[model samples]
Target: MERKKFLRNIVLVSLAPAVWLAACKDTGKPAAQAGEQATYTCPMHPQIVQHKPGTCPICGMDLVPFDKNNKDHSLTLDNSQIALANITTMTIGAGDLAGFKQLNGRLATDPEKTTVISSRVPGRVEALYVKETGVSIKKGQALYRIYSEQLASLQQEYLLAVAQVRQFPDDARFAQIEKGARQKLSLYDQSDTDIQRLVQSQKVDPYVTYPAPQGGVVAELSVTEGQYVTEGGAIMRLEGYHQLWVEADLYPAEAVKPGQTVKVIVAGWEQEPQQMTVQFINPALQSGSQLMQLRGTIPNPENRWQPGQQANILLPVKSKNDVLTLPVDAVIRDGKGTHVWIEKSKGKFEPRIVATGMENYDAVEITDGLSAGDKVVVTGAYLLYSEYILKKGADPLAAAAGHQH
Candidate 1:
């Protein structure tokens, strides 16, 4: 009993010293840890500081946290902020979108094929055969009637010389006068028929009919019956509508080249669009709309195509294949690089740097840093980038802290 009591007392003394030592430790000073502040100046530019904000002073660029090692696109943004964005997805099997930039243009007649029929001498119009435009006139069809004093005077002089030549056939002076008079009548718009008629009848026709200069469409008629027209007046405008002109307007880069074939459609006409032979490319871009003109000629025998009719033209573009593609809006650019936010799975994003190529306005091809089947954040990508950027800290786990791929 005495030995047991002594052992028990020894155990109590040992336990008491330990308990007192623990009490002394509790009474001593706590450890010295770093303090937190409401705001801080950047080492590079001290003027920059914000409450709950991490951005620089000199550049207004975001400040990176002292430590951030996680890789991925999964991030959380403020609940109150919303972003409007466009989203599209694409396959990575080496192809591009088969499409083009649409442009508007009109149908017209080929200027080179257009011909203006004019009066050879000043005259008062007597009648018009093909008065309105689009009237089909055969070659040599009588187009108009004209009364010209200039022409009548020359014919009377020719008749006087012919009478004198008959009266004095042996005289050289009469022969010379008759030859000069015949030349003058020929110059006064006397065709072979008119000369033959004058020789047979011995009478000159004062009023004359001028036939169509050429066989074609009556594109325009500038003279009216009983209207006085001056010399060299445009009596009619003619073009053989046997061919047509289709004009396509494109911007500088978008303009079809001189040799490129363009497909055109005329809506009202039921027949399929005839391929027009492209003949002219406008060297100057149109000032008002900044467009270039592409012209092609097609046949229009039925006069179905009128001037200034709108037409839709299709110009196939050079195609590319075997490329990784994505919607145009998915990219977020920064000094770091061109990057995209990829979703490894739900609530996770991996920020990836990409090498990009051959971008149309709507889509782009990714050349590197992406695999064929990687799911990317097409929508809400910019927001995720902002969140991941603003959420950095010594622990970096602050914003997207709970997300897991």
Candidate 2:
């Protein structure tokens, strides 16, 4: 009996560890079940899921608590994420909607303001005052010097006529001869000051310096030094920038009459918009194009604008009162269709397919799928779209479509 009692104590001592371990497991069973009910997923890699909070196996990011039972096509971001993404929202409301057709335009020199400087006499170019093509010249400024044998002969005739007139003071024929010589010099582009100086010096100048007819930017230089040119030969072309032409192509459907007012915005200088008047509209379509030419004039008193720069032309098409409108950035267009993000609740956004109407550079008209007082994601909507795809592993539009069906 003593040996049997000793054997039983040894058995009890060996079984004590196993029994304690079993009780501890039983106590943890409830906790394990609770952990199994609450799921955790990686924010960046939604495929990585676990029953308890821990680091994600795939991305090594901290896992966040996820509600498996909550099934909805929406995204919820924390305040920190929202702030980091620069998300902004606006409430929809009814207001006056002004629709404008934005047409691509370009700044061009007005033909009416352009002038061609030509040589009035046949002579060799002695020297050019303005050598470069883009030089700005003022009116009455010396342009070029021309050495001409005909001008020298005409000056000699004038000098002889003046001597004859002074010697025979009563002779009318010499006086008439002097008057004819003066008229001939004037026709050859000789200025009154130059003629007066020539008469005072009593010497004929073979090289006569001509002055600019008007102030403008030289667009072309046709003659070089020592280049002989005939009468009416182009010396240079100048363009005046006091007013610039805004030329834009318009579809036939866009009916804009001449004398109508339009808004012109230069690409680099958008802050200063000019209210220009439509000067002309082509009666026929542009060559090799279906678009018609729309032209307007904008004053550039400072000469700050240049030709060939890009511009945006706004033509007022229609205006309506009490129409729903939203910013152009708020709408998203994709393969699924056009949609927008609407804030269903605080920090929650859902995709909504909407129909849009007239649109301009900055705003669009919301025709359907929304109503007044609905909060919309005006900015940073694309960021939310990417976040939804990352967390949901699918496009929000696809889920929206499925719900619609």
State the C-alpha lDDT per candidate. 0.68, 0.87
lDDT by residue for model 1 (1-405), tens: 999999999999989989999987776534311223244334334334554556575766655442233443355333244234232233345566544444566777767767788887788998888779877778888988889888878888888888899999999999999999888777767877787788789776778788876777787778788999998888888876666678777777874667666666776652475565567788987877887887877667677777788777766665567778887778766544677766555444556677787675457778886888887767766655545544443111222233332
Candidate 1, lDDT over the whole model: 0.68
TM-scores of all predicted structures: 0.50, 0.72
* lDDT by residue for model 2 (1-405), tens: 999999999999999999999999999999988856867777656667777789977878787775665558898888999999999999999988777878899999999989998988889999999999888889989999998888899899988998999999899999999999999999987778878998899988988778888999999999999999998999999899989999999888887889988889898787687898998888898899899998888888789889998999998988888888999999988866888899999999998888998787678899998999999999999898777755665566776777656
Number of the top TM-score candidate: 2
Candidate 1 has a TM-score of 0.50
Error of 1 at 146 (Å): 1.9
